[model samples]
Target chain A: MRSWWRVLGVVLGVSVLFVGAWAEKLVVIGPWSGAEADPFVAVLDAFKAKTGIDYEYRTMRAEDLSKVLPAQFGAGMAPGDVIFMWGWWIAKFADHMADLSDVIADVPFAYVSPLVVDGRTVGVPYVVFVKPGFWYRKSFFAEHGLKPPTSWPDFISLLKRIKAIPGIEDAAASGDGVGWPLSDTTEHFILAYGGVNTFLGLIDGTIKWESPEVRAVFENYLIPYLDYASEPIEWTSALDLWWEGKYGIYFMGNWITGMVDDPSDLGVFALPGAKAVTGGPDIFFVPKYSKNLEAAKKLAAFLMSKEGQELRAAGGGKLVVRADVSPTAYPPAERALMKALEGFTLVSDMDDTIGGEWQAAFWDQLKLLWVKPGALDDVLRVLDEKFPKG
Target chain B: MRSSPRAEPRGKGEGKSRRGLPLLFWRSSRRREEWVAALGFLAIGLVLIGFFVIWPSIRTLWFSLFDAEGFAGVRNFARLFGDREIVDLVRFLRREPPWGALLHNLVWIVIHLPFTVGLGLILAVVFSKIRSWWVGIARGAIYLGIVTPLIVGGVIIRFLFDKHAGMAPQILGALGAPVPWSAGWTAYPETALLALVIGSIWLWTGFSMVLHSAGLSTIDRELYEAAQIDGASELAQFRYITLPLLRPVTLVVAAMTFLWELKIFDIVYVATMGGPGGASNVLALEMYFSAFRELDPYRASAIATLITLFSLPVGYWFARRRLRR
Candidate 1:
């Protein structure tokens, strides 16, 4: 009996020690995985090593994030200490967001815009996404003696040339299924055809939907471009096709860098005729309702830190938020991406400009336009009546 | 062995005295005991219904008359179909899935009803006749769909229906009646709705089959035998005996199917989200979109109310028939 008690005591002591070494988890939720989330893993691992604090990062779909966060906020349930969010969601959940001005004061002004709601800085910025880069297989372009175009007419000619290749299905097509990728790209059409002021005019009501400029956007830019694109499907699957050399080109975001199977073989060019490349960061914020507010703040602060941002940009193929952190500091992949972004004017995406309420209706209309090309007049008429500007 | 007149009076006197001595308001002790037991059984269920169903439905009804701002009357309902064009009305009337939420739901009803219940009834008939070691295995195979969750089934369907890699287009192409599904059916407007319908039928035909197989068990076998002995053909026997006998079961299936269609969410949600452009958009998806995306609970509530109103007539008929039978 004495011997058995001694063995049991030894086992219990080891168990207690093991349990004592583990910290309580600080849960963070976001829409990222694979290459995207891998960077955060490295950053978080460093945080854990430094502070002896642990975290579980959960990935969710953007659509579900929109639904889940609001419901969680409404129910007074803090699902996590930190959340990754899109621009429009910041508008919807601004009240529940903890102001991150103290943390993000030194971040670049461009990255700061999405997080500011009603003059309150509600989020810390990370993972800058640019929406105008068109990617193609370098070998495919080289074999065909093709070159990237400098203008819109040249771009169309290039698409036609790519199409003339024996079995090419599309020169470019959006991963057009649910909402985000297509909606992100649609604003580019407005920029490409009507110019930046014309695009902004529609938002402010100076330009009517019935105006010739908006009509030209539908007839000239959106429809003509979609002719070379594939039918609507999930964006991820579409990205897979781009990787497989099925589609010769895909005009989407820089996040595609994180998704590429091989970095060296990829060729990217800025979208032609757009006034600027329009997109911004996937902002990370600690919510006011967070159960682990201090830990969340620590995580956000670490993400913005030079060492943390470097690991994130290198591992995640992301752009840095800090102005001082140059592309040269990043790994070759992101460094190349930053080099590609030079000389292009940068503007905010429609997600930022259009705001939240009208965003859905607008995106859905774009989808409708892609399918029912004949429904353009009717759709615009409805959009005008529904969202009339003076 | 007739009882004497005094014997009768004694029995009558005991009964009369028992009835006359109702101290605790129990005229009949056995019936009162039965009533108490029945009430006890219903108490939990009633409380659940009151808490879960009744309260939510009442709130939905109240919310329907309002808009995002406040109680703006039936303006939300007007806006629900407010954007519809005359051509759209014609398109919806023609039973197409592209035009309107209400019309798409109607198409879902038309497609889902016959495909689910009819296929189920046919499968049930085929299943009922078999008696072998393979019986359980075959039945299990048929019920495999019902066993799989809707989300899983939807994902599988999406893969099988992929434009480049899916089996659907390949099979359809082989049939020589090729659909323009080179991009997959769900990638296009008209066909996205059809894809969802096909996927739905795949998921729920088994559900209908299970209900029908259970219904098939209670049917009297002798009726078929009697008709057969009288020189009736198998087809004639089914018509006279099985079809007429299965009316009640059919009503139950129809009512359940209609209700399910009225509130159907997962298939469309997981499969297409009423896209490639809101082409396959149904009332349930619209309600959810209106609530979350538009943040207009009034419009969402109105759509919910519309679904309920649409279901009431069929539900009422089912209840009435069930009570009568």
Candidate 2:
């Protein structure tokens, strides 16, 4: 009995020593819960194996991450050491993210510029998908005796041609759908005609919705598309028609490449470059209350490294930060058509970081313009009330 | 007589020892019952109330004070009242579309709740009478929906109502001009509401049935035999005996439905996203939009507070009436 008790004492002592040596686990929170690539899990697992540190990750809805994180920190809940956020959402919660200027200096300028907030490097840029101009099937254009339109008017003419074709469906339509394409097109139109500065003004709360340029952009840019979409076109139908060689054009981003590109064949085009969106970065942040700030920094640094960047490219996204890596970041076939085109002036998306509420106002007013024809002035009036100088 | 029984006196030492024993027993006995029952219940009730109710209420109330300029007392509320669009939205309360999408929910409660509760009661009565494998099959079929989560049911409903290959669409197409169930604004809201009703009715009716079954078991068969002896018809027996006895269960089911309808957020969120241009924007969605999407915590809190205030009176009435029954 004495010998058995001695053995139990030895076992208990060893267990106590083992428990004492355990490392504190870090909790990293972000907004990649549903469909987006979970980059954190991939990189963190490797870091843990190397450093003998463990991490716990939790995710909320993309929008909720910003709203809840601030309070989580204030309320003494476990704060996220690292955060992955979209450009617009990051701007809303900028005050809480730590400055990483010293950490991200090795990152290339192209990638770093978009992620910078208020002249401070807040996070590393990882993945980006830019929206650009699109065109109809080259074969369809030829059979219909149509030419590739260079300008917005020529684009309208192409639409007219497709409408003239009796059996063919109207230009890739999206009437009753969410109209995301129309929304994107409307912003581009505003930029193209009113200039990128005007769009920037809209973001900074300096431009009203009733400006002639804004009105002209809508009347010229979206009215023609909406007219073509008289058949209550859903997005699925539009994509199918485009794929089946039944439609003319679609103004969408490079993400739509997966839709348009096929194993057999495909056609692509850049928007008529009257104006273009130049820069925007996929941003990550370290929360102010992050318990594992050092670990998060290490992870962010790894993500920006060549090996980490390769992982990003493999995950099917453009590396925005690599200066040497051009649009040829991926293979030629994988290259978005926008990257191939020359002499296209690229201006960044409107400065959404100036104030978060500005974009909400702009989107609200823009919705009115799209739905109600005569409601522009009223929307503009509301804009004045909200953002007086703008 | 008592004095005579205690006449024999013990030694002083023995008497002192006996007094000490009784004193020790007296000290612990008073607290034993209360320590187990009262303190335990108080601790549990405090924990639940503190965690669930008090915490969220405090957080929501705190968020209602701020604005773009920072902390602005009553500013958000003043602005909410002043905003013409919000005012116009509220005006629908008095008009034909009063209660907005909540109108669909009210209609849902009125139509679906009764059917579900009535069917449940009748089936419960039937199951009580019949003793066979059919009873097992019937119970399983009803409970299949209860076992399935609302989201799973929603997906099934979505497929069933799909425009092209859906069972409804295919059947209707073969008959005549196939209805595009999710096409326009009118059809979109109506179809969404209908889908929710079907999912809700199918999922929840089984629950009501189980409740009614238990309620029915307590009813003595002798009463039914008595009714029969008095020559009371089946309908009359149900009206006089069964219905009166089942009032408490029916009331509980009705209240549950009413509360469920008021905050039917998940089904609507998953199915339609309050879409086809704000056609299905119920109070819950509106609160979420204000709080999360719009990033206006003030308005969201006010909306939540309104919902809480609205339910209080009904909840109080339920407590009173339920206790009486």
Candidate 3:
């Protein structure tokens, strides 16, 4: 009996130690999965190697974070130690978030403005994904003797050419799901036709959605060219269709480069004379309820560090928001895209920035526009009603 | 004879004191034990209901009274009436398929109710008449829709209406009909709500059928025989005998179906997401969007309150009928 008791004590002691070690591993949640998660995981691996603090990466949808986190916070619990969030969400849930001003003190205040709320820095900026323009397969374009258009008329002609191709139904496949992809495509047209001031005005609520300038963009440019009858495919599925040569072009963010099987086969271009593109940093914040706050802050600090940003930028499909991070850190194709983006002004993603009811209304109205191009008047009226000017 | 020890009488003063208390308190010891046992059995369930259902409901009601700025009495409710996203009578006048989320739900209930209930009754009665092994197979196939998770059913509905891959569109194409929804039925405003409604009918018909099937089993065959002997036709026999006899079952089915229709969320959420421009938007989906997407718990609470209010009458009526019976 005495010998058995001694053995049991030894086993119990070892089990407790293992449990303690398991509990110490930091849990991190972000909106990246599969290919998009690979680069971020590399950054985490580096952190683990340096600090010996292990982490578990949990993938969550960006939209779901807003829905789930609030309830969790209300219950004084958090799903993970470090959470990658939209800037708008960070602003919304600022109270529940830990103050990160000390961590990102050296970073420029202007670059992190979106992550700040009511004079408190609640989030840290890491990397930005640019919604540059449409992506097409280089091989397909080459096979059909097609070149990226540099003019509005030329773009329309290119769409027509693609439509004439056998087995292709629509000129461009409108990616959808809560209608954000279609809204992104529509915003490009608004920027192209309505100009930069109008785009900015719409975001700040200075310009009305029902304004004639915005109406003309829809009436004249998008409706005639866009295949409104084409079914709304999920964004990823739309990517697949575009990849299979079912559609000629897909308007999406530069993140697609990471998602694609081969980055070299992809080519992207913005609207001609459209001197603005939507892009913003993927902000991460530490919840106050995090079990491993000190370690979480350390991981967050590492992510914003020049070394970490360089690793992420080198991974491709993302651009470092930090100017100190060298452009040479990017691949050749990413470097070319970065060079192209230099000519245009970069703006935060409109829907993501002006999120809440206005964002939902914008997505819905754009989906409406896609289906019933004639309902432009109704759609605009409804948009204005949902998001009335001050 | 001497009194048995079990039946020994109490003193007059003690009996008088016990009688002075309420009848419940003065009940026999065995009766008191029965009451204690019943209360003990009910304690956990009552606590759970109080915590989970009643408390949350009260909190939701309180939350609905406030907005972002705080303590805006009736303002949120007023917004519900005025908000075009919640209720748009103007668009309805304009003859649009999507007037608003509330109207879309009404459209769902109006279209979904009849087909599900009617088809279910027809199937149950027809199946009852059949005496073959094939009948079980047929019933099982129809019931499969109910057994399948609604989330899966919603996905099935999406493919069922798909233009290229779905059977409905292909059949329409083969029939030489003009298919207006080239994208898929769920992709267009004109067809999205109707498509979901049709899909719901497929999902819910099995539920009502099983209920009616059980109801049919309890119904005495002698009533039908009496009607037949009196020269009543099959239709008349059904009207006079089966219909009257199945009143309780029909009431239960209709009441449950109505409540289900009012709270329909998962299928719509999974399928159209109340989209193709809010054409298929329902109240529950709107409540979710208001809470999570819009980050307005106040508005969500107001919508939840409205859904509960709408469901209360149906639930009450069903409960009242069941109690009266």
Interface RMSD of each: 2.3, 5.7, 1.6
Chain B TM, every candidate: 0.85, 0.75, 0.90
DockQ of 2: 0.15
lDDT for each residue of candidate 3 in A1-390, tens digit (9 for 90 to 100) = 999999999999999998888777999998888888999999999999999999999998777787788889999999999998877778878999988888887764333353677777788778887889988889999999999998988988898899899978687888877788887888888888888899889888888878888888888888886652255777777788778888888898888888888888988889877989888778888999988899988998898888888899889988877778777999776887888778788887888888777777788777777877888887888777777345
Per-residue lDDT of candidate 1, residues A253-306 (tens digit) = 877777777777877886576557777777777789886777778888788877
Number of the top TM-score candidate? 3
Worst 10 residues of 1 chain A by lDDT: A105-114
- Candidate 2 docks at the CAPRI level of incorrect
Candidate 1 chain B worst ten-residue window by lDDT:
B17-26
Q: lDDT tens digits, residues B164-240, model 2?
A: 33576566667775334433222243355665676678777897888888898899899999999999998898899
Residue B249, candidate 1: Cα error in Å is 1.4
- In terms of TM-score, which candidate is stronger, 1 or 2? 1
TM-score for each predicted model, relative to the true structure:
0.89, 0.74, 0.90
lDDT of candidate 1 over B111-223, digit per residue (tens): 98998989888888877887779878877876888788877876777776777778887787677744456447776676777788887887778878888788878888888
DockQ of each: 0.43, 0.15, 0.57
Worst 10 residues of 2 chain A by lDDT: A173-182
Candidate 3 chain A weakest lDDT stretch, 10 residues: A107-116
Alpha carbon deviation, residue A8, candidate 1 (Å): 19
